[model samples]
Target chain A: MFFRLTFSSIRHYAFRFSLAVLGLAISVASLVYFLSFGEGARRLIRRSVEDFNLQLLVLPPAQSLTVQPLLPRSLADSIRSLGVGKVYSILRLPYTAGFPPRAMGVVFGRDFSSSLRFISRYEVVRGRDLRDSTVREAVVGEALAKALGWDVGDTLTVGTGRYIVVGVVKAGSPMVDNAVIVPLNLLMEDMGTDRLLAVAVAPPPGKTEEVLSLLKREFPGYTIQTSEELVKLAKSFVALGDAIRFGLSSIALFVTAVLLFAIMAITVQERRWEFAVLRALGATRWFIFRLILAQALTVSFVGWLFGASLGWGLAEVTSRVMVEKFGLDLVEVSPSILILALLVSLGVGLVGSLFPALSAVRMDVREGLGR
Target chain B: MSRLVAESLRKTYGRKAKTVAVDGFSYTFEPGRSYAIVGPSGSGKTTLLYLLSGIEVPDSGKVLYGDTDLTAMGEDARSRFRARYFSFVFQQFHLIPYLNAYENVSVGLYLKTGKTDHGRAVSLLRSLGIEDPNRKPYEYSGGEQQRIAIARALITEPRVIFADEPTGNLDSKNSEMIFRILTGLASEGRTVIIATHDLALAEMCDVVLRLRDGKLVGS
Candidate 1:
């Protein structure tokens, strides 16, 4: 009978009920979408960083850009003899613009053959690495190719120098698709490398923190970023996503709550007479209140459907856009975030019904009937 | 057996103004009897019924169900008492607009007894001369709806039935039909109390009380 009463009331004023449902859906779906995209991007970024063995790297400082230090020339020479297995030299430069073979983007250079196991996030989809003897050979990512249109056997220009495209690898990471790699010296000096850039160190298993401490002690001016920190930087409130996600979700939670509250208050007023009648007909004050609450739940549940869809849509759009912009491989959905959104919707419904329930409870059966 | 009782009932609205809606009134009703309280608008007849049924608390009085003092009881206890021992037939019916006649009649039984014996609910409807128990209250005639309300009042086997203007919305024939149902409950050892201006039904009740202000006038 509680359910029946709720259902009947909804049927009696369907247009109002639908309005309430639509309002709730927008809030719930949008919230879920926002949270999911952030989560998805987190995973994709982590996977990309891990493929290149960046997950466990220990940095010099919490704010360092040197993801791998053992890959640098002078640093490699010392680290190779410091009881560490192999120290492959790697360099990375991050500015607004770089050479054209990398085409005005972040630049990375390292010994590809010697450090392939440690620093090779790329897959060599088409050609070989720049060999020790090859003076005019380099490799470009698919995205960089799409941007500048160069393939195998094509001549590429970088930092006022030219090189033949010797190899290609399809690395699905955002960093790889937007990067250009060359032999360490060729990237910095021989290929007219304008910048020395930061270096990555792939220490043997369990020795990462030890070698990282040594590097930090040796070079006090430079910063070292671990794989976990790098991944966190790429996905978190680092720079880009904070402004958008935080701004939208905050606004959504606020505006949606107000709208929901208003709708419930109006509904309570319209049904005041009915509530009085129920109370007159042997329904307790609590019974009348529960009826109103049940009504709100039904309406809010409908609203959550739309809200969840909108949320999922936002995530899908976010992941796709990020992938296109920076080659991020974020997932389409986030289950945890979806659950949170539904729970929020349920809460909204319960909270919104409070005043309405009170209104029902406070009615005077005799005053309402006017007898 | 006493059906419903009220003693020294006093109800005041707000503090300073303290409009006494029902003041120092007392009444006792017997089982197997029908009675009506007749008065003009603003009289306290309906208020008295609400108090006796345990729906509202009297400020300084006691409502008794057999020996239970309802006014001193908790709100939940009052609600349970009403659900088990009484049925209300309001002037406006209070039938859930979404539910059909059968559903409405079965509600009292469902809540108090937690049973959905549709056969019993339907059989009660049939006895009331309901044309189609499956139809919503709005679809039935005024009299058929009153009949449905009577069925609802009876379905729970309540010891007392309170009707506020039981025939207010019905024609003469429909009014008489409702009157017959109330009398039938009375004859079956149930108390049937109605508040109304209809003299014909008022004449049929065992005792007819009158209310001038909040106090009762002589029968």
Candidate 2:
């Protein structure tokens, strides 16, 4: 009978109850959508870090606020002479490298043998790998090829010279998938400099820290970092993104609670006479209180179910947009998110109905009837 | 059934300018008899009913039911006592708007016990000539709604029934039917107390008490 009365009352004020439900749904959906962006960024960074194969990176220390110091050829030789591990020097230069001179894209000049030895799974999907006989041959990553519409044997312009695309590689990382790769000597001749940006060193297994300390000791003016340290540095950049997501979710929940409180307050005010009738007919104050709470819970439960489904759908659309516009692989919607959303909605329901329930319990039966 | 006794019951309303609705009024009502509290407007008839039924506490008085001091009990205990010993029918036919006639009758029973007797509820509504138990209060006519309210009051089978103008909103035919129902309860050895201005209905009771300006003038 209690349940019947609660449901009947809700049905009596269906429009008012529906507005509360809609408010909760929108709040939950906004929370899910905001958190999804954080999840996407974390996944993208983690994938990139995994693809790098835990190699130690060595870079020239910054010389000025706006200028990054470059590694000369002599420094590269000195690092190679240490024989602590296999070293691969890479020179990254920004250039317009498409058929119609598109905006800046990275051109990587690397030692072919050492790069292949350190970076595993650098497979050539089409044509052949870079060889000694082909001086101006280049290998474009999957994303770069797709963006420029280039296939094997197509000529890609880099600065003043054009290199024939001899291979299309799939590196399984967004950073590598959007780059153009060429030989170190060819790139040095084209750029008129022998300075490199960084050196990737794959130390013998279990000798990572040993090589790291040795490199820092020998090259005092350079920065040395292990792959784990690089990953930690990247994660630091995403902390602000996480804080923004938290702020957005908090604001959404606040708005939802306020909306629910307003609607429920008005509902209780409108039904004071009805509640007083129940009280006059042998209903205890506790019964009236619980009935109001039950009504709020019913609305919140239905709203949460609908909100979770809407949030999932919206998350999928957001993931697709991120992948298309930013080349990020972030399309995962975890069950924990849905569970959290439901819990938040339930909490909102409880908090929002507290004052209204109290008012119902404290109503004056005579005054209410008189009204 | 239990006899009701009130001793010098005093009640007042408002803080700034006090109005004594019931002042030093006392009466004793016997069981198994019908009594009418007849008075003009502002004669404290409804306030006297509320005090006797344990719905409101008096300012300085004692109301007893067969030697049990109802005025000394706590509000929660009084509510339980009221549920077990008394039933009420108001002038406004205060039926829950959301509930159907059948559900409205079952509310009192459900509150006392955690269960409802649907069969008894349906039989009571049928006996009251309410054919459709599924119709809400607003869907019914004034007389039907009054009948539904009476059914709800009778569902608990209390020792005493207090009604404040139970037929005020009904037509002449419905008023006679309601008066007959109250008289029939008295014949069945249950106490019935009604407050109304209708002298025709008042004359049908076994005893009549008249009040003016919150004080009893005739009996």
TM-score of each candidate's B chain against the true B chain = 0.96, 0.97
Per residue, candidate 1 scores C-alpha lDDT tens digits across B1-219 of 465788999876778887777888888889999888888877777777888787779988888878889998887677777778888887877676778898888777876776667888899999888857889888988888888888888888888899989898988888887887787788889898899987778998888988877788778
Docking class of 2: medium
A214-333 in candidate 1: lDDT tens per residue?
A: 766766655666776666667655336734864687576667667767877887776676666555555678887888888888888778878788777777777776655545445556
Per-residue CA lDDT of model 2 for A79-187, tens digit only, reads: 8899978888767776454456542346877576464344355678899877862489898877668766789999987755789999998877766676688887778
Candidates, DockQ: 0.54, 0.52
DockQ (0 to 1) for model 1: 0.54
- CAPRI band of model 1? medium
TM-score of each: 0.87, 0.81
